[model samples]
Target chain A: MNEREFLKQYDKTAFDQPIFSVDNVVFTVANGGLEVLLVQRAEHPFKGHWGLPGGFVDLQKDLTLDDTALRKIREKAGVEPDYIEQLETLGSSQRDPRDWSITTVFTALISKQRCVPTDENVSSANWFPVTTLSELQLAFDHLEIIERALKRLKNRATYSLVPCALLGETFTLAELQHVHELILGKKLEAKAFRRRVENSEQFEETGGMTSGRGRPAAYYRLRPGAMGFEFVRSV
Target chain B: MNEREFLKQYDKTAFDQPIFSVDNVVFTVANGGLEVLLVQRAEHPFKGHWGLPGGFVDLQKDLTLDDTALRKIREKAGVEPDYIEQLETLGSSQRDPRDWSITTVFTALISKQRCVPTDENVSSANWFPVTTLSELQLAFDHLEIIERALKRLKNRATYSLVPCALLGETFTLAELQHVHELILGKKLEAKAFRRRVENSEQFEETGGMTSGRGRPAAYYRLRPGAMGFEFVRSV
Candidate 1:
């Protein structure tokens, strides 16, 4: 048969297919630590347990896996993330109780200031400190997924300005350094951090200043249309 | 219902599911350029068209996406790769002719010396220079998938010992530099490159010497049990 005829005769339902879903690990810097947004599942398998915001891909609505991730983030988190990236895809016959399943996990960074506390679809939504993940029960392999994403985010913070997505539109150098420190789980020398940021040329003065600090520090914002820059050395 | 009862009643066949598959872009340094392995499809969908080695994830045989990728590589290329990494997952309604399909792409690096050329499962298999990709007609979105994999491999080579996977068990420093140059598409200064490699401490002297070419060069092998190390500065 020709190509067109072959497609017409193809029957996808002849074989067993894995249940495919997209999950988002939305992170923000809050309460002096990195926090991940999670929603209490409203349906079976893991209902009432906290899980990453996600669901089955709507074949009619999603053009790509990314579209599924983005749509889920909006529907469950009620906010637009400042940055998002595909973390990894995990699959197995054991991860889900329903059947063989596969999920593509996405990592998103959003400023906590932009998020609404909860969405109507989920039983409840909350931002929980990543440090406390061990004490809580989560659905599927979500805890493992979040830990992996956290490791990636930490490594990324060392060479790129990715953690800036956790902050507001404008901030002082001290605030920026704090976000980096939180993600890196360590302190950075103030002088060295300033030099690295200046060399990267990824930010611009916002002509604003912090009001409550000991010394009024100037505010800066990421340059218009400027993407994250990779630094030669860790800050 | 309880978890066990819920799983027993859940029917995966009730809902329409997207076809899930894994594709691998296996790369190696050969003929003084970067090359990717492609296999001619023996099945009807894109029969006889050159494509990245890939196929449907067998529910009975594959436990994870990586397993599917590795199985396809072995079946289509007849070689064990030195390194393999997941690139990204791509899904859409229009890309596949049979159905809405989702594919997780993987990038692998292998030494050309080990490959057996053609495998029994494919019509034909060969390594094609990445620079000539535009001239060849590829099946599905395989061309776009290969390009994306190529870009990721190049970026990885900049700050990690990833490109070494494209060499035999032992290779001279000069040979390693040549492989990096082919991937980066630019010449690196000899002195700077050597310094970077030495500082990374990722290789050990194999106590061998090259037999051909202008001066005999000392050979090196990746340190035993050593994973790829990220450099503080790009080489």
Candidate 2:
């Protein structure tokens, strides 16, 4: 049926009424370490509760999903990002206190030193060590959300030097491995880990900055004169 | 100010709508096969579209988020899931063709072959070879949703032989490998893959049904003796 015929038959009474919204899982790298960005609640439900950065979706907002998440993170925390990814969606009923809402989770990474709690609603926005974030009373089912996001990054790290997004612009392989260990929750054999990373060749020797303290370490950046080392298909 | 005073000041006109709901991402292994179930669309605006099984969240129903997703999948496709997991939410404004919708992507796996398509609306419901699933034109952003689901399954497979849910009460090592290969989307070096599989320690020999063209593949079942895994942490 055409529009006119469809409307004539249409009940125009009621149909599916789902509350759509977005929630963010911003993960940033700073201080030679990996961490996640979290905001302290300022209102009820879980007032004084700690959670990932998120809010209701405003249909009127002129922004894409990714844009909205990044904007909210920056506005709420006063930090800009160098890397961001759409993690997953959370839509369990009772995930919220007052309504049945679905949340889209996104992840963002930036220099840890760059974030400062700027918004009034955020009583606190701090970077918690990735090794320890799992032990807190996470507001909502956010603990699970964080779990999935962390796992994705860990898998990504095996084929790509993604933890670099959680690292300084220039750093050592040892420093990078520390991030893999922390995120994967296991100690990777150093020799094998180094071999896999170097063989991929997504990094170029900067021949610039040296590792801080004691022995000097090689500096590298997004590889030049090299392809992206191919996105490895899952195996 | 308690309920009385708050109610007097509250703008009832600004807030008037029933709550929406979220589904889940479920994964399981049976007969040593890794497959995802889907439903044929029933309503208009992509009516008859092949998609994941889900529906509106009926908050008035005495069900939680988990229950809501379970009901939708079972009702829509007659799938009695052994395991159902919440993968993520897809809340894009344009996701639904006919109405404003916020969908929760839930991934599940069933062990029995009898759970095949039975619903009136579903033209067919069957498991896809996870390796070739990405090539199909899934409705909405479900294509991306499945990708995330498969990624979750692959990572989980390394530590937890969750794929056992796709296999039968007894199965061979080759069946297990096939399931993993299908989900991971690449052929595995049998020797290397077997080493990893045996190392996870979640499988047990059945001393039961074993069959093969050449060598008899050993039958194994879930080490029901093992305890459930804890929530994995994220990025």
| Number of the top-ranking candidate, with TM-score as the measure | 1
- Measured against the true chain A, the candidates' chain A TM-scores are 0.95, 0.78
lDDT of 2 by residue, A146-220 (tens): 878878877776666566666666667777778777666777888887677677767777887574678877876
**Candidate 2 to truth, TM:** 0.70
lDDT of 1 at B51: 89
Residue A86 error for model 2, in Å?
4.3
TM-score of each: 0.95, 0.70
Chain B alone, TM-score, model 2: 0.72
lDDT of 1 at A103: 93
Off by over 4 Å in 2: A1-20, A27-42, A46-51, A62-64, A86-88, A91-95, A116-160, A172-197, A211-217, A224-235, B1-38, B99-101, B116-160, B177-199, B210-218, B225-235
Cand 1, B chain, TM: 0.95
* DockQ score, prediction 2: 0.22
- Cα distance off (Å), candidate 1, residue B190: 2.5
The lDDT values for all models are 0.88, 0.64
- Candidate 1: the clashing residue pairs are none
Q: Compute the lDDT of residue A228 as modeled in candidate 2.
A: 23
Give fnat for candidates 1, 2 and onward, in order: 0.71, 0.26
Please state what fraction of the native interface contacts candidate 2 reproduces.
Answer: 0.26
- iRMS, all models: 1.4, 4.9
Evaluate residue A145 in candidate 2 and report its C-alpha lDDT on the 0 to 100 scale: 84
**What TM-score does model 1 achieve against the real structure?**
0.95
